[model samples]
Target chain A: MSDRMGEFDLIARYFTRPAKRAVLGVGDDCALLQPAPGMQMAISSDMLVEGRHFFAGVTPFTLGHKALAVNLSDLAACGATPTAFTLALALPRVDEAWLQGFSSGLWALADAHGCELIGGDTTQGPLNICITVFGEVPRGQALLRSGAQADDDIYISGTPGDARLALDALRGTLALPTELLAQARARLEQPSPRVALGQALRGIATAAIDISDGLAGDLGHVLEASGVGARIDPEIATNLIAGCAHAAAAAGLFPYEKLLEYVFAGGDDYELAFTAPPAARQAVDAASRKSQTQVTRIGSIEKAPGLRLVDAQGRSVTQTFQSFDHFA
Target chain B: MSDRMGEFDLIARYFTRPAKRAVLGVGDDCALLQPAPGMQMAISSDMLVEGRHFFAGVTPFTLGHKALAVNLSDLAACGATPTAFTLALALPRVDEAWLQGFSSGLWALADAHGCELIGGDTTQGPLNICITVFGEVPRGQALLRSGAQADDDIYISGTPGDARLALDALRGTLALPTELLAQARARLEQPSPRVALGQALRGIATAAIDISDGLAGDLGHVLEASGVGARIDPEIATNLIAGCAHAAAAAGLFPYEKLLEYVFAGGDDYELAFTAPPAARQAVDAASRKSQTQVTRIGSIEKAPGLRLVDAQGRSVTQTFQSFDHFA
Candidate 1:
């Protein structure tokens, strides 16, 4: 079925549709959408490169899913609901099987999330995927990093540093227990976007950001935005490390202090980290229960503006920080 | 500066802003935007590759401007008002001078058109640019290709085939008249998006699209969508073909019919082509008078579903049926 069509025909077959909630869709010069009542639209974009963002041998299906998933995670961080998306793909050459798998993966996520594919452009070049997602939130109601206030409690959903370990296993830098390796691979390939948790925190959380660049780096973003400081417990991070052989080896390579640094600085975790006032802790706890996600308190926002990692003895540890940098 | 700043800081320095109408712009997880009252938002995306879309040595400034310009032109085809844009760029490395020039060009256009830089992504890879633009139009009033009817007169704005000619000149395949070469280059590098013309046609034109892929190929899109055919005059197309020396040389390399073929099938004109009822002809004529641009009535819609081009002797020209195919 893929072999029978070219790019233009594929677009016309799969993407072109009349305006539904949209004022315009694929057929016209541009798509037109009407924002829902009393809501401002949230817009974000992300680009995935073949060698940089993912391994070259990974299936296009997983690539597509991960590409859109990362951008949707941004929407989740802002406490917005996904609405629509546009894709721009640059490929070295037309590969029917790759395109079929890619579209299938993209459509799956779009359908499940109720996000419509509205516009896209395909061209010949190195493999590159750029997606811009649109969502809706009530005006001025979006959660922002700058909203983190001094004395607010900082909490993170799910676990951290698992995706980084998965990458190590993939790179053959370490070995992993088979069962745990598979689970970590799945986490890396298809992350569960924290949309529900983000929406749940809209009214109660003081500030929030998705943990894409590991806990330490992303939390630093929140701290910088809010003009505050934080002192995180290293024991809690060490406990959160997944029990896999590769993780164990990677942990062995690092000193106890540096192991915690990996949890803080390694990236690709789509978990949400947020701050809330002390008064809202009970409500936050209840909301997390309702959302079926763990909300673990890690620290407190401080009046000063530097990040400190504290040992069990309550002494500051100095270590180099390493996080994913697009240009690096 | 480029080495010192990572992706986030670069975004903050260049893109973060609170524009006049934007509810939010840059810095956050997502940008928030509000559409004008009673107006539907129009959206379009285009991806430009370093080698395929433009020459390798093309300035970053022109590349940035052209990327946004082409998408904005799509909104113009829909008769919509410009509002906001998102950019997705992949690069091998961050070059400060390149980024500075690119951002300057993007911000210049955004400021001129009242479109804010709302959101986007940056990643590492071969150079590729994907830009999505948003605009607004009255509800249910967007210009559409499916709205053309039989017997409606077809009109095209500006001259055709210049960009293709300029491309040939740039590749050293053909020598162009010095005066014409500069004009052709300008047409290719800095396309004048038909925003005003589109706004003027909001109530009068039956159907419209921008002439990106020459006159004949794009008109065919309208014909196919509207379930109609067209009969265009070759003499009228010939009159619209500037840079005749290049055209004549190109004709020699290919065939005499090839000149007409390029005029009909060549793209990147970014001019408006629309079908208007005979009753609205006077209004179109009056509107055309306001600009130096000439609006030529070159064809009429037919009941059938194929395109035909007639010579001065009134014989159908088979070669003019050829059209540009992006994938082919």
Candidate 2:
């Protein structure tokens, strides 16, 4: 890769490989893709700027991987199979080592999901990475946030909040045991996109969203879009942040209940939060089993206008949750 | 569309609209598009950073217009039909006025091109705008730089160097009469994309590229890709600068010859540079007539290995052109 070389040279060296899966790839005025017959193209974009989205001294490899991963997460939420992506990058200066690591990290995830780097623009500016990913789903079968029904059960794939816990640990607001810290840090840096699970659950999933700005906030989007409310089980929700007590103990919390905040409100988990009809529970379980991803039914959609937290016995709880807001 | 408001609310208020063309639109995990049958999807991305790409005093409306325009220029170069786009914006704060103007400018051009705002991400950070545009072309019909051949006529659309002259004027490096300055400034802030001309040129223009980093540098890309050289006519190239003679006179140049630099090396022209076989001259003229855009033949492709500048006579001219370099 020509990271430290001239900008066009860098693109030629790294981003300009021949278009294999793509109808046309890098080096043209634009890249071309051919979606499968009778399919809809799913498109999503995400931007990450240095010092805001990432800490100083973070490796470029992690930055590249996370940049594309975030956009892919949106595709996974829509149950689309990854196809292609374009990157627009602004670099402070050409650093060969950084570019090599970054491109390696980027291509690893892209190749794993069969996503091709189609076209991109690289320029001289402050460090920023923006990626737009494209995927495809069968017409009328793709999942969406507005399709949830009042009686549908809300489920999340894999785990949530570990990335937030890692953020908290890095910020020194919380202390974590070695094992937990390592696990959380990994999640923070390289959270997996639930693409296989999302595709597998397509028709079975009534509505879907990737848990990003915390379960409380992101689910709020589902509620807003689907015109439905939700009542989440706090007991099961707390289990989502299992083993975080070790971190709370390390921090010497008096009530030891602060761990619950991460459970309900921590963002960046990159997990899939979907709703499925109760009658389709077997199908949902089967899809999750096929993808080898753990599916947790943590709540039920309701006709009410807002979200709620309930005790295991179904009594209302008085806990407030916060969503991660870029502005707030 | 959301320039200054709270991110999600801003999106809901301004960008969340029903997709008349897209299968899915805003408020979902991803927006979905279905290319017409037997068509390939053409995709391109561009990133514009505040200060690096534009002056601070420029309006959000102009910023919005230019961001999309540059990407559309790529579509024009590829002879792709404008279809859809995604915008990822980073802003410092929510300013209702700015968002309104920006969205207004953005939509004006979008509607004119029939391009839909598909999906995007908005976040808090240093001000930056990244857009990825999608288009469509019949399979195997895309105009590529690599398709240019020896003996092809090299052509450009509209004007070049006016934007660079505007840039120099903004930097106080040149002076111009008010009328001249205003015209140049319009070219800088709101250069039009030759979308129709591009679509019409398909199957006629052998190869094409958009003049972005200056004719000299951008044409270098086409030449490098096509493995051919060029001999540009100085008389015709000089006329491409149009009314810049007043600025050169104001700058106290002997016989006002400095205008040539702006013609050859000035960047941000956003015009098309294309190649066509001499035999297709009649068809090229018909395409230009159909698109109602001016097309100029400025040079000829050659079997030689480097670009050469020629006088009104056939002999070569000893001259130099400077490209806009971000790092330099």
Candidate 3:
């Protein structure tokens, strides 16, 4: 900490780069960006705290990746193309090695999406990372949570519960094989934002949301906004946990009850949950193939008022699950 | 904290509002904003940490105002018109009174500029406030630090150093009269960002920057970016502290040396320091009058390589001042 560079030098060394998409970049009072004509800017902000958001001993590289990934996930939900972002970070003290790893991970993800690093502030305090990301979408074409309608087919991109399984293992509440634990841990740490899939779903999906606070909770947001309900097939949802379906059933390792809970209420999975009319199923499939991401149809939107879990015969299944809440 | 509202309830009650300037406001994955055609969006972010930027027990109202005010000052420096902003806040615990007071203060200032609150994240952690503000400037019309030229007259808007004086008084390092202390403390807690003045100077001033890290250091940024130096008149600069001129000279309240130090090295003064060619002095005066903010000419940009303090006779005077640094 004592040997670390000053604030300006630290910013210049790690974050400063030539502007490719922005009219003005770092080192100015404000970064200037020109949104393309006929485009609307989509903006979102996310904050990651040391203990609340991540474990105390988590590596800086993954922390960096997850911080920006969460915000980018919001853009993905809006069907926007990545543009630029600003990072405001508070550190307990300056650590060059940590900074190097953090910035490397940040730039890797940013470069993959052609998102420019713009202007932000860095200060000394408890470790906190806040990123505000900007993206552009064609006017009136942004996928919104309020756009869902009855009879729409509900779909989710990628798996959603592996992160929670990993967290359970790390908490010593569950036992897992070493390789399985490693694979699940990566899901917990390095969330990949489905930017391309989001863009591909622009005209197809009626509504979308990023699954961060568990499937049940985040899906609730879309339902509430769209004034609709959903009926999810429990069998399909339970199988949405990658690699766990075969391993758990074949080895008779984890209980079915725990797997169900993880599937519904496992938070921190940066995947996309979207809804589209049944008529657009082929188009949705094409979008999935275009983005090279798998899509799973696990539910259907309904005119009812609450979420329901049903069996293959459409019989309601009673289950109690608690979604993640920051205040709670 | 245990009895507080849930995260979604808290946000819906306090932060959610109807969109006026933004295409979409709170309660969305991402807020949509449409900049008027041919306008460039100017963006900036600033983070404030408790125990570093503010005292442990500072009032929530002032903290809220100062947090957004500082970021608005950045837009002011760029000569942009405020549009919208996002706030990502971390709190140690939930307090209804704190939330009410903070949100009231935040909305009061935000409404003054017609800036809408878009989208952000809230979580449980050590207290921190990070705001990313957006504004718009006509293309190629932003006031930048790199636009200064030799012989440009440097000006200061409003008064500087009163906030620092109040801070010193609070620290018990200085003694000020009761009434004077109250006035200065208000300046420290509730700064008025010169938004109108910045917009007024858009086509007049060559370069501009807000005095955050003290006048000397922030001015250094303009000078470095413009590849120019400056000569400041200490006598004029020292008198820029509000209400201190007659009080200090007549009553001998504070030392001249300390006053000078505060004038140049005092941070947290959300005032604008700008430069304009001498030929535009009348236009500058008109801008100052139009914005209802006072402006004073205290220095002149030069072709030399460093800042120099000069007496009335134009002879160099030796003085050293250390600007505030987060890690220092």
Candidate 4:
């Protein structure tokens, strides 16, 4: 690659281009962009380390996509449309193959979402990827967790616990059917962000968040933000995990009442959990139909703070809330 | 510290705050921001890796400030007013003192520029800092290097070579006068970006770029972008270096053309270099007065496509055009 071109030449070759609505693109010292009219910019960042965020053996393509996807998930939770992004890649060396794959993966997503890759920096170090994404939402119309009110219906899109189970299967801690293994591996490799569902819920949903750090922990964020409580049906959460026997068996490893723990506390689901007012239920349904996104109402918001889980028999289920913790 | 909170809590403590024009800062999944009316958003990102951007022993405060400053320099080059930023920091371990100092230094510059720390992510790894800064300029008014025309007057802000001298002193390759040494150290620790000067050039400058990768290399960028050439006087560059020799001599370095090379090829000056039509020269001066910034006419754009350095006697000088190569 060095024989072909230098760093600046490489940047100009693959990264510099004008995008629709971009006031300024590459070649300038920085990019100047116009945010969508009447919209506020939604911004989020995520950093993936060599060992902490992914295995060292993971391809740069997956690494690049996942890095951007994680941050995009944040934008999706806020009902924002992806617009632009900056990347910071620290590498041990300039691996040509790695860069090609990484750039291709990043560009694929960027093009698909109409998000332009604007600015970035590259440096020498152990591999690390940091991506900051910008999105736009109508002013005063962002879906925030603070809007969840008592008695509002709580809904989640897509399946949870699968990604976590996939990780377990990868670690050889669990056995899975061949077809299930393929599905789990795919989920691990390329988790989808609920962008469409989030945008659909823009006006109708009272509050929303992406299930990143498991349902319980992420829901805790909503509870803290909205100053409310939630009583989720443990059976519903358990049944979600029971869809896969390997995950169900993994759940059996925990205490009897804690089978819902993985669904509630496991992270990296990248699914949206939202709250909608009783009056907007019809609108929410309409949005689900329009967006073709599944919306499952699993609980109701309460005036009291903290989370409670009830079994099918309506008995309180006591369980340990163990999920992904940054330090842990 | 881990005892206090997790990554999210740490972000809340250090990186979240209301910034100028920020509608919502740091609490939601993504920040909600508003750019100044009639202005476009200028965005830039820079990543600093340990042992690559700075020495491993450097203070976290200086590192943090430098990370933000480098990106702001890009905005300043574009004649944009710094508005907001997001930081991505990867560390091998949590060090509370380091975080405190780093955050304090970062906030110092942010507050001064009326920029808010809107969003960020923190994770574990070898120390890597990625900062994305936002600035605003009037619509269709961003200064671009591609706008430079042949026969345009070339100008730069402030002096060069100080940062290089400081780096030399820091590496023990040079000795300097005590006062000059302190000043050079300050240049390295808290390099001032010519934001006002860039903003002053908004309407007057035909083309512009920030002198981060030395005068020669960065000017080459403008030349290439504008499809023009430049003839810089070597004596003028040498004299500029001569003026800084007291510091260099005090730092125990030779007062020779090598010093000039650093000024011409050494990077990280964070000064603006721009071209302006003859008719706009007076207006440029008026803008300088209005913004309380100095504008130094350095050279002239030429019809040719290659860069040349000529002596007072009009003889071409042989000098290697070098700058900071990120990959190298």
Top lDDT model: 3
Stronger candidate by TM-score (2 vs 4): 2
- For residues B1-328, what per-residue lDDT tens digits would candidate 4 score against the true structure? 5554677767767777655578877777898888767878888888888887788898878877788888888988888998888888887777788888898889888777888888787877788888889889999888888998988988877667777778887888876778887876777778777787788888889988888878888898889888899988866665544335434643456855676676687677777888999888889888778877666776788999988888789998887866778765
**If ranked by DockQ, best first, what sequence of candidates would result?**
3, 1, 4, 2
All DockQ scores:
0.70, 0.65, 0.86, 0.69
Return the lDDT, model 3, position B76: 99
- Show where candidate 4 strays beyond 4 Å: A2-5, A240-259, B1-4, B241-252, B289-294
Candidate 2 residue lDDT tens string, A112-212: 99999999998887788899999999998888989889989999876676788889889998667788788888788888899999999988999999988
The C-alpha local distance difference test score for the whole of candidate 1 amounts to 0.80
- Estimate, for each residue in B1-328, the C-alpha lDDT of model 3 and write its tens digit: 4446788888888899999989999998999999998899999999999988889898888888898999999999999999999999998888999999899999999989888899898899999999999999999999999999999999998778878878988899878889888887887899999999999999999999999989999999999999999999998777654544325433577778777777788889899999999999999999999999999999999999789999899788788878788876
Which residue pairs overlap in candidate 2's backbone? B4-B94, B4-B95, B5-B94
Model 4 interface Cα RMSD in Å: 2.0
Model 2 iRMSD vs. native: 2.1
Candidate 4 lDDT, A95-178, residue by residue in tens = 778888888878877777788887777676788888889899999999998999999988887777777777777789766777
Q: Model 3 Cα displacement at B190 (Å)?
A: 0.3
lDDT of 3 by residue, A1-328 (tens): 4455789888988899999889999999999999999999999999999878889898888888888899899999999999999999998888898999899889989988889899899999999999999999999999999999999999998878878878888889878889888888898999899999999999999999999999898899999999999999988877753554335444677778767777788888889999999999999999999999889999999999689999899798888777898998
Q: Which runs in model 1 stand beyond 4 Å of their true positions? A: A1-4, A13-20, A240-255, A311-313, B1-5, B13-18, B240-256, B290-292, B311-313
For candidate 4 chain B, which ten residues in a row score worst on lDDT?
B241-250
- Candidate 3 Cα errors over 4 Å, as ranges: A1-4, B240-250
Worst 10 residues of 3 chain A by lDDT: A241-250
Q: Residue by residue across B229-265, what tens digits does model 2's lDDT show?
A: 9999877777653545435545564243566677778
